[model samples]
Target: MALQSLQITALTAMRARDVSRPSREQQEAADRRPLRDETPRRDQPHRGRDR
Candidate 1:
């Protein structure tokens, strides 16, 4: 039905908007350290696992 399609479209648009924007905590963390690299280094060996 046309009404169901409209509702689905509205829901999809809302979800897209939500996904496009970051939350307040994320924005604050980004602001605190804008240039720091957060990724784990591949050269470092795992510390806790026993071989």
Candidate 2:
């Protein structure tokens, strides 16, 4: 019974990981793209100030 419960727990953990994995990948992609996009836009004013 303990072994069975352990197996069930493992399966549930795997399912949860699988569900979250895609959203994690999407967040990583958004972070990469938006970081670059936002940096330039934010830097524009700073650059202007320096000039």
Best candidate (score: TM-score):
1
Per-residue lDDT over 1-51 for candidate 2, one digit per residue giving the tens place of the 0 to 100 score: 676665557889999899877677788887677555466454345546765
lDDT by residue for model 1 (1-51), tens: 776665557889999999999999999988888464675557866888657
Each prediction's whole-model lDDT (CA):
0.80, 0.70
Candidate 1 has an lDDT of 0.80
Worst 10 residues of 2 by lDDT: 36-45
**Model 1 off-target regions past 4 Å?**
1-8, 36-51
| Model 2 score (lDDT) | 0.70
**Model 1, residue 42: C-alpha shift (Å):** 16
- Runs with alpha carbons beyond 4 Å of true place in candidate 2: 1-8, 23-38, 41-51
